[model samples]
Structures are given as structure tokens and as C-alpha cells.
Target chain A: MRIADAGDPLMGQLVARYGAEEALAQVREGRLGPGFVAEIAARRGKPIDCERRLAAWRARLPYVDAEADLARGEELGARLVVPGDVEWPTQLDDLHHERPLGLWLHGSADLRFACLRSVSIVGSRAATPYGVHVAAELAAGLSEAGWTIVSGGAYGIDAAAHRGALAGVAETIAVLACGTDVAYPAGNHGLFEGMRARGLLVSECPPGVRPTRIRFLVRNRLIAALTRGTVVVEAAIRSGALSTAGHAVKLSRHVAAVPGPVTSGNSIGCHRLIRRAEAVCVTTTHEVIELMAAIGDDLSPEPRAPVLPRDRLDAESRSILEAVPSRSGAGPATIAVSAGVDLMTTLSHLGVLAAAGYVERTDHGWRLRRST
Target chain B: MRIADAGDPLMGQLVARYGAEEALAQVREGRLGPGFVAEIAARRGKPIDCERRLAAWRARLPYVDAEADLARGEELGARLVVPGDVEWPTQLDDLHHERPLGLWLHGSADLRFACLRSVSIVGSRAATPYGVHVAAELAAGLSEAGWTIVSGGAYGIDAAAHRGALAGVAETIAVLACGTDVAYPAGNHGLFEGMRARGLLVSECPPGVRPTRIRFLVRNRLIAALTRGTVVVEAAIRSGALSTAGHAVKLSRHVAAVPGPVTSGNSIGCHRLIRRAEAVCVTTTHEVIELMAAIGDDLSPEPRAPVLPRDRLDAESRSILEAVPSRSGAGPATIAVSAGVDLMTTLSHLGVLAAAGYVERTDHGWRLRRST
Candidate 1:
């Protein structure tokens, strides 16, 4: 299962069956269970012979040099956490379509705990002074409120967020698109090094991986998935910071956008987001804190309010309620499919439940009546 | 009756009753009815005799010498229009509580036409280049769409708005708080002169009156009343442009505010207005034009949609419809008072109307359904 054991016979079988890219895509898609990727390769007609692929994989190891890089990372006191590890954040499981294969972590803080109360602070690299000041204030306030800060290790708003968090006695996490050891933007070397020393620097890419535009966009998903919310301090209409907001929304995480002067292009994206109602308008740290608090317990499966008198329900009603996902706000058809019942049965039960105040229809869809 | 006939016996009567300051206040409030001072004086104690006050008023006449100044303005081809004159703008009638006494005018554009189709464009005097550019574009677009631009003849956004409007086929109007013969800022003399030539420069005070803080605020009412809408491009929270917006709202004119970056203090006032629902968010000339079109036929006594249906109605229904104002939305109690019927009768009719789909209840109150 470890990437280190390239010479193991099973590695050849896995690669031959799934092909390298397809296998990686499957793993990212969460469809390739542990030890099952080889089955997919056989189905694809590759019929990978484990022994031969393993030999070829070993022969190419010297040039790939992943083992040596892993050794170096471990020597530097960093831990490698793969997808199935206990410390892996479950919230990140939301990125089911584009999940990372593994993460390189260099820090002391528990990644899961860090993510539970974390918020990503992102903005344009060429941020104005007002943007920087507002970003720093937001970071400091969130950190002081017992939340972990998350950001890129670049200059401008990113560096400010990390610095603000450090100032508040709380550490931050820097998620880089490139390798953990390399700082792509040379000007941000000091900030990258500072984060590694006192906070955490994480990357899905192997050591020595160079930063690319595509990688930056891909990295946005990780930042969005690893936090409770994303706060965009300032961004031009075409700035990549909006990518993080887009991913945050897809993952159903809270996205808070700051407002700026309509005259400034830097704030155009944020204003557009507010106007479209894709993000809540946040002018101060207090609003950000309130948004976080509202969604704070959303990740858990614990009843948001309480089980709405389900004990007195009939079998059909109980089945329909049970079929509803804790947070997905399921409709009657989806509930029926999940409950293995016909649509009519589900609808009838839902109608009764609704009439009895056991469930309610909301703008979001339908859900058990929390007020009940 | 006329200011020039100082030797008339009515002059003594005016001085005996009104004095100078009281008369000016009454004039500013638009309550100086014709011959009011003469009638009041005639009603007061014994035979009215005011030789001393008349002499003082005549001496003070030099300071209020609008006629002498008018000769200079006339030499410049400008005319003055006092309140109640045939050519006076009817829109100014909206300033019931803070009306101006008169307007000094320059240019051939009809005052009434300009007022009916005008939109006041105001912003910070120390506007940024972006603000100035947006103001110009907005003004030009509005003018091209047949809107007459109205603004204070100052620097930054105001100057840009006038210039942009002049560039288009539709001319603009400048309302100055200073005398029509004087440019208050001094630096804008060129703009002032250009406006006088191609557009119009108007003032409430007489030709020689100097600009003061009080006059500037009072002058805002003219800009607000003379326009169908007001667009605030940029303003700090306490900027005087907001006063114009207040007047626009009071005059029942459409208030459209442009959104800006929240980080910029210049946009904070506009943002607050939008948030409070005092102004609709507008980003382009089309939106402004649409808003104006939506508020068409401004003088129609019944501009609002009727709330109730008349088809298949009885005496109670007719009574209810009669009780409702053609313009103002009314509740049961107010309807009862206006209909001279009991509260229960009004409520009963409202219930029938609601059931018949003639009226709709809303969170604010109630409104007539658009269709019967």
C-alpha cells in the first residue's frame, strides 16, 4: 500500500491492470478501494502482470527517486499520511471527485483538529494595502476566537493571514501546490520557511514538483476541503482566488466574500459573488465568525436539532426518515430509492409527516422539522 | 408685487410685517404667498406705518440686490426663474418642507423638460481616477439614452459627469449653491462657463449670493426634486451626496446606487443605502433607464397598481374600493375611516377581496393583485 514498495509484485499487477493515470484517477475519485485497483486494470483489457510491472517499476526507481525523497522528508521530521490513515481529515472526503492520493505534512498540529475549525484566507497576490490590512484583521480575529488559520504561503494577503495568526498565539497551515521543500515564488521564501518552523506546510505533490498554473487551481480544492469556510478578502474578477470560492461552494462549505469599492478591479470578483448571492457579504471579522459558528457543527452526523418524534412513526415513515441523509436534505424520490420503497409510498409517508409537523419543506429542499 | 418697485406703498407694509430674515425664511420654505406680507400688515394693529423699517429694508436692499445682479446675468444671456413663474419646474413642488425660493438659469433647455428627465450624478470631490471614469461613463450612457444629467458643478465626478453628458446629444444641468454669476470653487470656472454655453447653470440664491455650507445642503433638494432618479457613484459615509439621495427618496423619485468595493470608504455610503433597501443596486445605464421607465407617468395621481377587483362586486366591495386611496396602500382601519364605514365592515370586505384573489397580503402589509 505504501508508495515506497514499488518493487513489490503487487505494484506491477496494480499498475498493469489500471494503467498509471487511470489508477490515479480512480484513486482520486474514491472508486479504487485499497488492493482493488488491479481488478479495474484487468477489466480495462490491460491484464497487467504483477511480476513484470513490479520489475519495470523497480528499474525506473532510481530516476523517479521517490524513496530517497520520502527518506529525506522523514529525516526532516515530516510525516506522510495517505488516504486511509486515521489522521486524514474526513471533511476532505467531500472532494470525492478529485481527492488527493496522499499528503506530505510538516508540522506538530493534528491535521484533523486543525481542519475542524480552520478557515482559508485568500486573495490576489498584488493586493492593495486596504486588502492586506483587512485580511490581517480577519485572520487575527478568527485565530483569537480559537480557530486555526489556513492559507497559501505566498505574499500579500496570504502572508498577512499567516502573520496575523502567528500574532494571535495560534498557528496556521500553508497548503502549497508545489513540493513542500520548494517555494515557487522566491519572494515568499521567508514566509514559507517561517510557516514550516512554527505552523505547517502541506502538499499533495511529491518533493521537487514545480508549481504550475494547473497545480494552483487543483490546490484550491484542497484548501477549500480542509477548512470550515473560505473568506476572500480581495480578488479581481479573474483572479485565481475565486477558484477557491468555487471549490468551497461545491463542497458545501461556507464562503464569505468581503466587499470593496466598485471602482477597484481587485474587488470586482468579491462584489460579483455578493451580488449573485453565491457568498455572504462580510465587512468585518464579526460577520465571518458568525458564518463559521452557523456551519461549525455541520460536518458531524449528530442530529442538528433532535430526532423529530420518529419513535412514534410507522414503518414506512421511519424508513423514509432513516433514508434521508443527515445533511443532504433529500427529496421524496431520493428517499424512496434509498429506502427501497416505491415513490408513491414515500410521498404518502412524507405528506403525513409534513402534516403532523414531523418534517418540513425548506427552500433548500426538505428535511425533518428541527423545530419539532 | 415686483421686487423692483421699491417705492410702492406695499413695500412699507412688507417691511412692517415680515422684516428681512423672516421673509427670506418664508421664501426658502416656499410659503411666501402673493401679497402675504401686505395682508398680514394690514390685519395687524392700527393703520400700518413702517417708515423706519422701510428705510432699513431699502438700505439692506443693496445686499439683496438680485435685480442689479440680474442685469449682469442678462448681459451673459442668462435669465432668472422665480417660484410660481410660468416657466418654473413643477418637480420642485416636491420640496414641500425645504423648497428653494427661485432658480437662476442659463441656457435654452426647457427647465421643466430637463427636470422631468434628469438624473442627479454626484460623488466625492476628491474622487479617484476610477471613480471619475465610472462617473463619466454613467453620465454619457444616461445622456445617450435621453436622460438629462444633473450634478453640482464641482471637481472630480461632478465635472466628469457634466463633460460626459455634454459629449452626448442630451445636455446637462448644473445646480450651484453660489450665485449664478459666480463659480464657487473658482478652479471650475472653465467648466462653469462651458455649462452655461451648452447646458444650464442654476442656483436657488440670487445672482450675487456667495456659497455657504447651509446653502449647499439646501441646494441638494433642488437636484433631488428636479430629477426622476439619483445615482450616487462614489461617496464617503458622511458625504453630502447622500443628502441628495435623501431628497430623492422624499420626492418619491427612484434612488439607484452603484455598488463598489467594501474596502473603499468612498463606496461605504452606497453600500449602506443598498443594504437598507433605500436604493436599488445599479451597475449600468440600462438599469437606470429601466428604473425610470418603470416609474413612468410621474404626475398620474394613481401610479400604483390597484389592490382590489371590481368584477362581481356588491355594495360592500364598492365601499371598500372607494375607501382605498388610488395611490397609497391602505389597511382596514384607514379604509374604514376613508369609507365612513365600521372597522368590521372594512375587514369583511378585505377578506372577500383576499379570497377572490383581488388583494394579496404581504409581510409589509397588503397590495392589490395586479390582475382581477
Candidate 2:
């Protein structure tokens, strides 16, 4: 928890080399390896006192109480899921050194199982009604199709997506920048309660830790890593939602954006992603599935036109039918001559066409069947 | 004019084999080549009497008067644009043997020159108001960008495109299924008149010929071939506009479709085209231009966000700016420690940041600039 916000490469390298327990012990004793002092100096472009840098870690050594933090989480019905826990999602490891040391999970659902087939729905907090509606509907449809929905529990599109998914059968996860027990926005307090009971509220921040601007940005990487893909519902050209999409791209996860009206300012980011070939343009659940699902598993059916009786006819039959008069009937021989077909073949086709209601027998001969 | 409606492979093959006049002479004199009967028989899957088929052509001999046809076209203020005419769009030859023998044109603008840099905008005739608005806006923008607009002279989207283009500085062409002298819809008479005065109305039919379903289908090929690309503004899944897109694809022309709300049935064809990779998804005039314009030419500037003073900062400067307090002031030494930079670098960047309106020196030290 102390190191959750420490994304520094130098600290990460030390933790990776000595392992967490030995690294923590070394940091407390101010003995962080033999060559680490020179490496930190090289990275910082200066050869200052390494002991001064280690002072910050020593200052918090007395307050580093793991038992108290775990008990506080247990009091809130949350659990600490470490790297080797059964409930820890393995996909987060794809972040390498940037991955959280531990995840604070608050929910009834098993996090790892739910995330095995999941997609994140994210967008701007100031989304228009069109975006909100689309996000909710898409989440509902995806949930109904048995896929989990993941998102940051912010306002606008995020809230709508969680609400929509909650109304469906599948679980939804909210990867928060603050502690799972804390509702930073306050407006989403009720929504957070609902998620705690039904799905999951996940965060790297320990109990009582509040969200900051930098935390929100860092939190986006978790949302992208936990899912099979990330869908940006509506975002401005410079929205933070684009940061999540960028994380998804870097993670090699499928990235898709929902297209809306060109006149809508909110759709510009989505359109830009599509135009740049950074994301696929997806409008429906089926299309999203087609992008994220295994190949040949969730292929959407081809767009089809309403079928007409005439569509079933073979080419030769269509030619013969064209020769049949619409209003007036003509003799078989006359129709054959106009159709440029042999009389016997034309006569056989006429009988078949008449039986199929494409034509009817008149006093003169066969004519097109008129709908009455 | 006599063979304008005869789009048969046999007739086209004969015209390619011999020149038009010589081919007509052979038909008139009943002197079709010695091997012609076998080829026709092989294509039709039967041996029929050749004389009976030639009789239809010979029967129209009295009505095939080139002088009268040319005079009628002149009376309507239209001109015959043969293959070699300077006003004929050579791009139409991309249709290969399916290309029309001649085009009847009525307008002030040069057809070939106008078509040199043009894009056709097509959609369903029963377009929604949203479709109509988008079509007009796209056409107007494209026209303002100096690209000529081409479309069928139908109601709804087609009429809106022409009207929008007319409102701009560029000419707009209406490629009609009927003769240039006839306005099939009657309701678009005013729109057609405006086009004839400022741009070209082109067709393969003679002066009095009316439009039929098949003629409309065949005419779409001309519109697709006469432009650099085709943009379907809005369309139903089975729309005739898709046929135009298909023709454009067959001719290897750039095909683009504007995206709309998924809630709209009218946008189905456009979305399907994009999903199938049959068309590039275009949302703005610049995007359309980017698709049709040559590489390294007319490329749209990347989507930009409202710039902030901080956006221009270098990495070290951004770090220093982040360390600067938003509400309270901090000394340069304090900020340097927070920003992990040297005191000299922080002091230099703080001065530059102050000049750029990103920070202001305060009574204590320095704080972020507050917009008034």
C-alpha cells in the first residue's frame, strides 16, 4: 500500500531484485543493496547522498502496519488479494513492474473468474444523453450475452453502464482509484453499495486512501489489464477515457469505440480512434463480441435484406418470369418467343412459377400474380 | 441511341470486335461474322435460329436516324458526348465493355473537368431528417473544399446533396437514369433546372427516354465511375446506394460511408459496409477528403484539444509545474525536491512558466496561475 503510488522505475527495480519482504527489510534498515546507490544516482543524473532519499521510506516505517490494514478491510467486508491469491486476476501481471502489489477487493463475486471473459466500458464524465443511453444498452446486451462488464465507477457513461449491467444477469466490476471501501465522488455512493453486493469494487489503494488526479490516471491501467478489451463509449478529443484506451492498446488488448453522430462533439475521440486505425468501430454487442471473441466463435451474421418470393427464383426462372406480363396474360409460345427460351422449358417453368404464387393461370395463359 | 438500351454482352462484344458503324452495317446487311452464331449459341446454352434474333435489330433500321436524334438533343440544349469528346469523362472507361457508347449532356460546366476531382454522395430516397442534414452538410463541406459533388437526381438525400453543393462555390453534377431533357420525379424539376444552369446533367438515354428500374441500376455505374470516390451518406441495408458502392468497389475506387447513430435503421448499410471492410468509415468532410485525396496531399490535421500553457512544457518543466502548488506557494528548493529536479533547473523553468501564464510568483514563492 505504501508503494502503490510509487511508479518510479528505480524503486520497482529494487523490489524486483530483492523480493518484497527482503526489499522492505532492506529499505527499513537503509541497506538497499551494494550497487543500488550508484544506479539511483545514475538514473537521477546526480551523485547525491542516497541516505537522504531513503529517509522518506524510514519516516513511514513505524506506521507500516499490515495487520491493522487487513483488519480495517475485513471490517468493511473487503479482502486483500495478493499476487498468489486464488482471486487475483493473472492478467494484471502483464503490466510487469507496474502491477499493483496487492488488490483490495470488495464484493461477493470471485474477481478472477468474472474477469476471465470481460470488457471495460469507459467514457467521459460529461457524456451526452445519447452516449449514456448507448453505454447502458451496450452493457446490458453484453451482460445478457454472459460477459462481465468492467468500468471505472464515475458519473455519466460509467454509472449508466454499471446500472445497466446490474439489471442484467452478469457481474460488473468497478476498478476505483480510491480504496474499494471509499466512494471518492460521493455521488456514486449508492452505486458503490450496489456493486459491493452484486459484483466487485477493486482498487490498489489501501483502506482510507482517497483518490487523487494522478491516482485516477494510474488506475486506468488496471481497468485495461483486467479485461479482454476496452470500449470507449463517448469521449472528447483529450479525455482521460483516451488514456484508458491507450493503456488497452499498449497491453495488446482489443480496442473498440462506439460511433455516434458526427455532429456530436463527444464522438470526435471515437471517430479519431477509428480513423487512425487504433480501434475498431463497434456499434452493437455482436460487433464488440466479434472483435474480442475467439476467431469464428462469435462471428456476426451477414446483414440480410427482407426476402421476397422472387429472390428464391433461379436465373433462368427469373428470365422466364420477366417475360410473363404483369397485367395481361400471354400464351406460352408467345412468352417463350419474347423470353428467348425453348417452348418446352418455358412451359415447365411457368407451371412451377404458377404453383409458387409467382404467377397464376388466366384464360389467355400464365400472368404475374397480383397481390390483392 | 438505338442500341443504348441493349446492354447485352453479345452486342457489346460485337461493338468491341468491329467499330460501331461497321457493326451496325453488318447487322443491317445480315452479314454478322461467320463464327458469330456459334459464340451466341455457346453463351445461350442452345442453338437458336440466328436470323430470328437479327430480325429484331433489322426491324428498328427505319427508326435509327442519327441526324434526327442529334437535332432533338440540340433542341433541348443538350450535346452528344462521344468517347473521344473532350467533355467525356475518361474514368467511365473503367467500366470496360459495359461503358456506354455515348453520353447526352445538358449543362454549362464541363463534365470531364468537373469529374476530375469529384465524389458522389448517395443514400436512400426515404432518408430521415438526420440523414438529409448530414448529407447536405457533407456535400457542402466537400464542395467548399473544392471537390465537385455527383449524385442521382432523386428525392431526399440526393436532392439535398445537389442543393448543398449549389450553395457552395463548386459545381454539382446530377447523373440521371432518364434523358437529360427529362426530370423523372417532377418534384425535383427546380433542383434539376438549377443543376443544368450551373453544372451538368448526364445520361446515356435519348432525349425522350423515361427511367425504368433497370435503367436506374445501370445508371449508378456511371455515377460511381465518373468520380474519384463515392460516399454513402445514409442508407438502409438493402438500399440502391449499396449498389452504387458495389460498383465503386468493382472499379477499385475509394469507397467511404458516413457513420450515424446505431439507433437509426437508415444507417445500417453504411455500418455494414464499414464492418465488412467494404468501405472506410468517414464522419467529416476532411476524413472523406483524406480517404480520396492522394497520399501526402490534403491530409487532415490530427484532431486537436484545446491547448493549455502546460501542454507546451518539456518533461522537466512539466514535472516542475506539477510540483508547484495550486493554492499555496512553495520555494524553488522545496519544489525542486518535490519535482526531483535540480534547484537551478526548477528556478529556470519556474521563470519560463511564469512568462507562459502557467504560474505566478507569490508573496511566499510560486503558485499555479489562476484563470480569471
Q: What's each prediction's TM-score?
A: 0.56, 0.88
Highest-lDDT candidate:
2
Report the error of model 2 at residue A339, Å. 8.4
DockQ, all candidates in order? 0.06, 0.36
lDDT of model 2 at residue A197?
A: 84
The ten-residue window of minimal lDDT in model 1 chain A covers A298-307
Give the residue spans of candidate 2 off by over 4 A. Answer: A3-6, A37-65, A313-372, B4-6, B36-67, B312-372
Tens-place lDDT per residue, model 2, A1-372, is: 563243544556667778778878887777879887787679779985656446545545565688899899999999988888888899988987787778889998899999998999999899999999999999998999888999999999899899888988899999998887786779999988888888999988888876766678889999999999999999999888899999999999999998888888898999889877899988888988888898889997766899877778885587678768888889987666555555777889999988888889899778888871
lDDT (0 to 1) per candidate = 0.70, 0.84
- Compute the interface RMSD for candidate 1: 36.8
DockQ of 1: 0.06
lDDT of 2 at A19: 78
lDDT of 2 by residue, B242-308 (tens): 9999999999999999888888889999988987789998888888898898888998777799996
Enumerate the chain B TM-scores of all models: 0.64, 0.83
Q: lDDT tens digits, residues B1-372, model 1?
A: 123121123433344357645655544443554666466566664554343333333333333555566787788677877656877987775664245545678876778777667888998888877678889998998889788999998888889899889878787899988777776888888877777776788876566656655567767877888888899888777778888899888889889778765557777777667655688766667666777764453221211223333535875476566445433467676566444345666788888878987777665455667664
Real contacts recovered, all predictions: 0.17, 0.32
